[model samples]
Target: MKRLLAAFLAVTLAVSAPIAAMAGSASLILDARTGKVLASENGDVLNHPASLTKMMTLYLTFEALNRGKITWDTPIVMSKYAASRPPTKLGVKAGGTITVREAVYGMIVKSANDAAAAVGETLAGSESNFARVMTQKARQLGMNRTAFYNASGLPDERQVTTARDMSTLGVALLKHYPREYRLFSMTAFTFRGKTIRGHNNLMVRYQGMDGIKTGYTNASGFNLVSAVRDGNRRVVGVVLGGRTARSRDAQMAALLDKYLGRASSGGRLLASVGAKQPVEVASAAADTDAPLAAAAPRSEGEAGNAPFALGYSDTATVPLERPAALEEMANAGKPQPSIRGWQIQISAAPSADAARALLAQAKSEGGTALKSATPYTEAFGTGANAIYRARFVGFDSEQAATAACEALKKRSYDCVLLANQG
Candidate 1:
């Protein structure tokens, strides 16, 4: 069984001992550049995100990087509260201070609880405060159903997020901070001058796996939030609350190939993981509820780009003209009416401040940039997920997002466009 370390726990070091939960159901998703959902099953049921919450933590940290609040060389002190946290930690002493870069590695590659706690302490004076910040940012991202009780995503029933929500977070993180997102690709991290390999076996074994994170906790089950890139194509995905680490990793590997294609032939790869279980990570979702049950047959339409976001809780936003690709559901309910017209996201920054600052810079350079928040922020939080989107909405076709993205890239902002299903 390959290590399917939860991305949230990857930051926390998965330090806290998990109570252990039952095997989770399985689901899958594929996407296009337009922020669409291609496939999913049982995606929405508010399952545990486990350590995946740390992904938000990393996102926040990346934002700080943009504002120059802390540099890679900045040392993060290990507080007493941080030291007191559970296992899967870096075990930093009270007086011990690790560089921001080291702390990031410990969180992503090692999933050090101590590292995540340090970030919480360094960012907001305490984990509780940082969690508040996280929740606030989550609201900004339109993650209406999410609540962060802890930074480490230890099994608090309240620390719930859906797969759809997680996907939203993943997309935001990738698009919001392309430069910083590379940190997720680190195959191994060096801490205390000792190198530890990341638990994300896919990065080591698979291709185009830049990253995201993996997580687990007793209540959250084995979970994985991962992504893959193929030339001009890129996609972000998540699998939460599985029976075991092996099952989660296997399922994700299979899913990645299904969407991104096999390297040899550029076609979908064979399913390496045998029978998949149901997915339990609601937080894995970014926006709306999961699709029908995994047992429900996948619609031929679900495999195509349909502008939509998944959520750990639930909400649906689609343009009536172009429906979103089918994804698993986070909960049971009628799909909301699609919002008409195009939804455009022109720019993404490591943080809202940085994004705004960049927009200011753009305006000075004779360009138009607008900053707005989305429901996605409520679920994921500002930690780069609640990106400052600069766009021109109300276009006849949804291509405005793409047009804006192309225009922004000319000025050197790596951009992607997102739209709604009509």
Candidate 2:
């Protein structure tokens, strides 16, 4: 963490003490408990996000764990792709599996690129798919100024966000996933008997500091997402594009101190308490805004509505056909023989209760495949995550399914052929 404070400013014409100096850089420090902005510097200007991408990665993961889509104990299978991430990573080799509990640790403390990919793959079957899901969910969270191209915040011209948008994410993370959010406070994470200390200076040197994240790159400079709790009051701060590690941290400390005094000045920061009203969340219109696809109809007359996070501007309903459904496949006479090219071996939930979720895709597609869990949409505290499977069971030929899987993999799906005889 200290490294960033110095290295960041080496190239830039230095700014004086008592004030952070850097142009094209933006920052925000706010009251985490009260949601008040303390200091600001072009907080809304679009800039590269760097490793800050992982915060959302952790955010969506917490949601998955809470909803039972995954558990902390669940093992995350490392993939060749995940192992390919750049350094500042754990370097967990492909085919080695780590429990979700450990992956979070590796991500938080080590900032392991491998762990980020593992989490992305585990949730969406590929990082690309997960990135798609991330952007969709971000929009739903009212992150109008942001888009994510990957789980790791490597620079992408199109994958950009502003300080303001990140503040929304930072606060939402604390508000929505308190239990999981605390994991960010881990000053150090030990894995395989080795300790990887966190880079956030606040966790170690500052008072009331908790978990969040830090990001850096040639393009992004030094970025930190931080939260502090002083007594019953807590605040979140985002400092981006610092020229030096000390500058950023000191800047953060100074910013937080500045705001807290204002928040307590007259309790004016919380003055809007009575103005609060239920705000139905809506997504910033995509280039082409579209509405949620129609819910799938089951043979038993059940309506399976997948949670779609996209709130497009062009609301055009396809009135299209739901894809093949599992119930329909079972209802229709003889079970089709095993699909040759692509298939997913679905483990039925215990007591067969989880079958509907597993079969959600089949239900939505109008019974083309079998699902084991009830097909339901996953809603995090602040966003909706729809379950989407590009490859399901029962392809008639491996040649075609393999072709599709290959294509989907390029788009970030680690699709494998699942042979099901049952």
Candidate 3:
């Protein structure tokens, strides 16, 4: 019954000064059998989703397959755009053709941006159009806070989501397409004579943890959405904005271990979190946490068909596991004075520099409304795992905050009005 829910951040820096080690954390656990939520914590807070966005990409692809719009053997050619995406990728050259089956494997196993983009373009004629469809699909599935800007979960300030929305997505993926969901459990697959392993470590290490996805961007932190099935009972769990993968996985495992039994036998109601009303679909234009230079391609036939053999380098995979000692580092810190006013958060960044840069671009795009607000960076998370949030903090009233965010949104920037919780 006791759950360490909110991840706290100190907020007592001088105005406009950047603070260190503050980040957001959110989670959701539900009984997959009954669609009943078991636990929720900051589940509605917007957080950078990272590669978890690919789950939607895969979902749409599965829809296409089922609709007969695409077939598994259909060719997914790597365009200049797809080939241009940064790695952890299968090194299919521009114009090189990989079957839809290979692309699916590349996505589930390698989390390849190129493969995802290829799938998007192949199905929707362009990634932007595909993203439009994605947003529509999200709205249909009740993912109101979610937005898509690209096929790949690469950093775009406009892309954002929440834990509850993702938990809903995970359930929808399984419930609507049980057959296609089986692909998520695949740990490795052979593609063009190379065997590629997946990054979802829980699929290999945890009991009944079949998988959904794993994501990381400096902005999003480590994220995982996983499902565990015990006989006829199943539970789905989602963790976002984790400081590290090992810590994230540990948190996920602890949640499943504690709740699986109860969920199996009908867990006590935590709270009924309903989805926001569906909105009309709007047209959309559309990494790892580390620099992708280390993600070089494997030479053909290098991997000797080992089950779960991966194609990425050590640096790309090393960060996936954090030292257990670091897990004890509490996110809670000394309380600081509240800003005591409303503000509009625009985006998140891995560093102060990035946060400042985003602020500049937002100001340029959001000329008038942003002019009155002071731009600042609030650090989220603690220690080396922290991320900086770009925000226009310091509004005297909630009405003022809402007005500013609405103005910014009209100009195509993502904006959320919120009161500071210092």
Candidate 4:
């Protein structure tokens, strides 16, 4: 009888080992340009997605914004159900309101479950209904093996996705919403007087990694979907069911190291994917949120002379449209003469003086490249929340602006080229 019991126990252990392994292991890497699978292991195995579900929620939000169903200033009121979601949240109370911009930052930077729920409720009127919409959208996007039961990736046996499906979603985000996709690279954003931070630490250490999502739960272990762009190469990598976040990130970094080099350096992948060309949408002036900041430390090979100051962040700008009256005020005391064509922005600063100082420093360091350019400061927002953009205008063409920007970059200045509508 003892021998029989031991044999039964041995059989049970053997049977459960593979099941456990399958439950907690899956990974895939793909070239975003060619859609070629670089490497995969159990990529089709279903697993919980955890907070990674917020990516889809944000995707739909971006779609809605593009469709004009909502704007950045649109308010998303939190229902009691949404506000009551578990921690890693913005903690907006029931009946409290946050703008669409804040909600997007909350979800992306903090992985706030409450923000996700509020966004879903605002979009679909109910969480269950939103789940259905999410599932339907997943199907539309060819995420065949994926399903979502909630806006937050809270535990639900029904909420499952495969690594391959996640890679598809990552690529879809980059292809379909190239402009909005930049939000994912943000590591922190100020919301409602509080600074909410993100947990995607790997992005800081790994060169070229930008916006993506990370997830974890007891059932899902640690999951991460990462997108990396080095020069002309781009790759999306997904790892699910890691034993810990560190291990998951390590694995992802290793995969990117091995596969990113092999990625093809074709032209814009968006063109090949048949993505709609991004159009310049009219910017709204009322949104008062601070610009999201990518706090990632500069990695080796990055061109930066000095570390960013305490309040200085990434050069990415929030939409800076000004109301007619405010626009007049911002341009006040400046000559409205002959600078036109294109512009290059160097930085956004907390105060107008700081912005001017940045422009002055850039002019001094920029050498002959910026000697003929006109320095301008554009102010946005109101009172304490206001930020100023330091810019150089008067480039004759896009190529001229691009050339100047390239020269500034080599000298370790962050630059963004823009068409001068004025």
- The candidate maximizing TM-score is 2
As for candidate 4, its clashing pairs are none
- Per-residue lDDT tens digits for candidate 2, residues 243-313, read 87788788888888777556432232232211222121111100111122222222211111111222122
As for TM-score, the candidate ahead, 1 or 4, is: 4
lDDT for each of the candidates?
Answer: 0.55, 0.55, 0.64, 0.68
Candidate 4, residues 40-72, lDDT tens digits: the string is 998988888999999899988887677555679
In terms of lDDT, the best-performing candidate is: 4
Give model 2 RMSD, 1 decimal: 15.2
Off by over 4 Å in 3: 1-23, 264-422
Question: RMSD in angstroms, all models?
Answer: 19.1, 15.2, 19.3, 22.2
Query: How many times do residue backbones clash in model 1?
Result: 106
In Å, residue 158's CA in model 3 sits off its true spot by 1.2
Q: Clash totals for all models, in order?
A: 106, 49, 9, 0
TM-score leaderboard ranking: 2, 4, 3, 1
* Distance from true location, Cα of 193 in model 2, Å: 1.8
**Cα deviation in Å at residue 178, candidate 2?**
0.7
TM-score of 2: 0.61
- Model 3, C-alpha of 102: deviation from truth (Å): 0.9
